[model samples]
Target chain A: MKMFPFVRGNKGNLVGCPVPNAGYSMTINIGCARRSLHGRYFGRGFDSHRLHQFSKGGDDSLTDKVDETISKENPTLDQIRTVKKSMSGAISDSVLKVSKLAIKDGFQVYEAIINLVKDVAMKSARIYMVFKRIEEDGNQIIFSEPSVVDIEKENFDKTVKLFIITKKSTSEIESTISNISEIESVSVEKFTAEGYQTEIPAVASILPPNSPVIKVLLVKIGDQTYAIAISNIERLISLDSQNVKTIEKIEIASVEEEIIPLLDMRDYFGNVKISNARQNAVIVEHESVKCGLVVDDFIKKDEVTVKTLGKIFKNAKEFCGGAILQDDSIALMMDIPYLVEKFSQVLKINVNIGQQHDI
Target chain B: MTFKITHEPFDVLTFKLGEKEYAIDVGITEMILGKCKIFKVPNSPDFLKGIVNLRGEIIPVFDLKSMINLEDRENSCSNVIIVKIDADKTGFLVDEVTEIMSIRSEFTTMKIVSANYIKGAIIKQNRLISFLDLQDLLVGKMSAFELGGKVG
Candidate 1:
């Protein structure tokens, strides 16, 4: 019986296996296999009420090992230029820089790069409580939205591994297992490596089926789940000597609709335009300019009126206006002109994100 | 209220989907490649046409025609204009090679959507062109290759 061949290791999760019409699916429940997440996060001695200051995201242990795995390969600029030609001008220079740095540092940062994650911000402490079954989704089910019960952050970074799951519905729970991303390691039950019937010890986990085509690898961060989609799963894998714990359980959360993907883009070309820019960001409109500047993000909207904060940013590169937000955080209103001039020397225009293929 | 391009001329690199014309600011137009090999990825977002290898890097391309609720036309014109517009590394596939137009100033170019994030539309070739409205194009879509953001 060549089932999807992959099955969650824990027996409890196996109870939820092979959902109706869902072929090649199996769930296993390893109860509290790594449920010390609260102590790993909240137990940290640092005390801070802020998000960014406390936002040193992820228990970066195993990932650190993974990052270190590719340390020996010293990728060169010339190699990148050659790859770009193969990439047919899709890889942005910013992304290439990161790729080079990753190759130099022996890690891959360009993959699974989650940013601006506000919904699950510093409120990780609250999520910690949910891990203890103190909270549940709107349904009164006890294990509803099942969270990690005992996983900690340190154990995550030190010992966690990864695996792949494929073909899951949007925003729908992949498995009965709660929080699939937080588990440390897994076994390849029904996977084919290099077109061979081979099973590798998976360092990550995916939702199954959907990830098969894109080649996504799901990894655990503290007690959260994130997907790493790419073409070459091998180029993305990093080897670590540290032994992380096997996954106990995952809450299997789905990427929601209307969820905004965060950009790693900083200020581009200091020119701004004052149009619908009031929403996410403002565009600086100059009378003689051909292309205006685009602010990376919107800190605020509809405060007072459309006016600059009397700040002259002629020499300043990215920002022009300095307006205080309602939260009292001073946002440097971006200057598009200066930014463009600053980056004018850069090899502009390349797609740095995901899915690489050869045509 | 009227605004003129006298402030500045923003060059919008426009493209055609089937026979209709659409445009986005050239700033967001990352790569305008002509006719690459595209592979069909199962269970992707409906708008996503398939994946392509520029060289070794694989990029997911979206069909602008299919995105606008238009019917799929077989073998009309298969020129994929891969636009890496946002953080998602998404590609928008347009049909045929149309010239890039620099839009002069006009405030009425923006078309209004009925209660959606679509802010406005632009007029091209005398026809009311509904621009990609990138903000709206991305609003409800989930991330790539993830569950719910992927195909079941």
Candidate 2:
């Protein structure tokens, strides 16, 4: 299988470097060509011979250096062997580093390519080609259809799989793919032009015409019932005082081997009487920072239309907005991310202050 | 021989807060709503009673008693007077809305008080009614109220 080298500071351009042979290893030049040229080659199936030619033309300094050493008059066999071994070692090291980088930055590169394709599709009015599956031999089998492409492959192989979205007809695409000897097979499924018009509008109309309804986990703290968007909540767990631990005056609870900082809703909201009743904690993740919000009880999850808290409450950061419940009572929607961030910062400050007091 | 005293009589909606009577211009009053559930907002000042969902619109209810530092009676306030200041609608929780009466300009006097919200005092009958400037009370004075006060 061929391995693609992803160079750092190369602006996400996939530099195709053929794996070195047993001897006479080729040195890789990390400098990549412009994005336009990369896109052009990527859109057309990658021809290994053309890629090799491109790499050779881009830089030949290292290769030329190795050539000059071998071409030296009366060069010993031992010297030649040493040079080959060193070249092989150097190429192997570069390959290992590039492979690691490729794995780490693979998702970013995929996102960038997807965004690029979206921009192109918006401008050209071309539909996306669905990536159907990848064969055991690393050949990506793509199904070309009109609109809504589903990508099934999680892991990628050496050959850069290009989903060439185009306005061209199936016959035209098939003829183009036929010219590229690298593409093993081309399957054409003819969709009528009217199908394209109908499908595109259907996709656009799928978005709700009215204000979008949000599903929220209704939670009660004190006399007030608040709604936390279900999307922000990771899970809900029952908690007792035994489960809670205080570190530097900050309450934390360990759930499933993960220690989460807890912010008591009753305490945070300044409820006069702190209840000794059984409590539940809603584990919420905001921008990857996890925090557990302690609440008195959990009501059933329901979909509600959130209305903005008027001008007077415009400065209230604790609540994002409020939604009228079925009982005609309004439940304030908790701003999860903001509260998590604010709570974390407060705990950090308190911990620091405690440390200073000890000092 | 008759003495005709010509003075512009503007309407004022009078409401009771504790033992004191407060009046705001009737023109600013949107509607007087009965006792509805006021959802307590976290990290809000004491003067901010809570938010009320009237129809579909969420309007903030301010405790007028707390704003003016009057002794707060327990669960006595049922009337929420919705007033429009500029483009914003705000609700004031008071004991009760007594009346909407036309008070002549002659009865009103510019009395100096510590509270900047009170524009003047109108002497109606034997009782003195404090004329409130709703704009001055609610707008640009949010920082004056202590934040993170207990919410019921």
Candidate 3:
């Protein structure tokens, strides 16, 4: 119970005072050591021994002050309590001062900078380790594969979030943000018209040898493509949609970067006439003739070449025979003659002509 | 050269179909007749006046007034003509037979309206009488007629 004299400073703070003839470090110069620690506090390691001295008031100056009082030969209990109280306050004040000075000294500013290193010295075997664990909780996402290029941050509606990438971008990282709605993580951002052209990128095919492609009609509408397959081609004579919208089409001879549907033909060209009266169109002398069991819409008058469409009805694809269009997107020519003949039969109309008509 | 010029007496049979008045060539007159009921044919041409039986002959009667784009788009019929066709000959009914007259060759006139469709005129007592070329008018043009069409 060695005690310090209760000496209140003008600021009303309890500070310890040295006993007579017991002052130490008049030769060792411990304050100069504390000055060096200001830089050490921010360095790679902390000087734990010196730090402990600061925390425990192990400074020879503080010891000399206590030793001088101990020579008083076990002072009264009241005197012991006063010394303990005053010593604790002085220690705290010194720690805060070093922390502030450590800030200006270009080292890491820390509370208990020296004391912390001494306490955790066993954990790191590093008495010079300066960083102290204030408070921490285990959290944060653990990614499986860090080599997956990078995950992206994006926004939709109003919420900002992250998006993962599986492929390289031909466009900007932000552009991939437009596709964020397609990802499963964000269902609320789902785009109604799914599977856009940006996703199903087109590959260049320069294969000259023609492969037997099971043909279906692909209709190019705006940027979207539609596929239609006709088995009983005769059943449709006319399906008219007065929904007329005029599109400004560049009348070039070739199709450059045109996106066509997987297996369908454009509705623009549908019915083809066979007979002479139908050179311009299928002219029916019998006026009342209309749709019955076969022959419906007036598909365009064009010839689709001979290529047997294989067992592709499973895809439920739509197309006529493959007739190359003015543009290379390929037109599957429709058999309006066959369709008309079949349906004309069910409608009780005769389409079988004995004479050949010249165009 | 036995050439004697004289005005031949021809009747200008006038009649009304809805509102307009018209007269056909009387020198080519076969018969001027009135309403003799008719039979309807399905899917017939718009101007097909109907088929009529006259003197045991099934004559196809056409209302020239309506057929010639005069008062068409109407349901009323008043008159018809019974012309002895070099092809099909039978007397047909018309509206009303007015009178007969004699006109000089100078009064006789003709003209073509549209290059394809025909239109002609004759002066009768200060009134202009139009004679429509039925055959040419029958060959009407629809939008399907495009350039590079096989005219043959």
Best by DockQ: 2
Local distance difference test scores for all models:
0.30, 0.54, 0.28
Which segments of candidate 2 are over 4 A away from where they belong? A1-211, A272-277, A350-359, B1-6, B72-74, B111-113, B146-152
TM-score for all predictions? Answer: 0.34, 0.55, 0.26
Candidate 2 or 3, higher DockQ? 2
Q: Per model, how much of the real contact set is kept?
A: 0.00, 0.52, 0.00
Top-TM-score structure, candidate number: 2
lDDT of 3 at A181: 29
DockQ of 3: 0.00
Which CAPRI tier for candidate 2? incorrect
What are the per-residue Cα lDDT tens digits for candidate 3 across A1-359?
A: 11122111111121112112222111221112221111232121111111111122345554454445435543432233244333431222222332334334433321111111122212211110111111001111001011011111111122212111112222322333233322222211211111211110000011111222223333333223222234222222221222111222211111133211111122222323222221111222112332221122233433222221211111111222233332332333233333333233322111101110110
Q: Rank the candidates by DockQ, best first.
A: 2, 1, 3
- What TM-score does chain B of candidate 1 reach? 0.72
Clashes of 3: 37
DockQ of each: 0.01, 0.19, 0.00
Per-residue lDDT tens digits for candidate 1, residues A1-359, read 11121112121111111222322122212222211111121111111101001112232442343234324254322222233222221222222222233335432221111111234422323333322221122100111111111122111212211111222221222121134334222222321211211111111110111111222233222122112222211122111212211221111111222111111122122123323322221222223322222222322123311112211111122322232223332233333333333232121101100101110
Give the range where candidate 1 chain A is weakest over 10 consecutive residues by summed lDDT.
Answer: A347-356
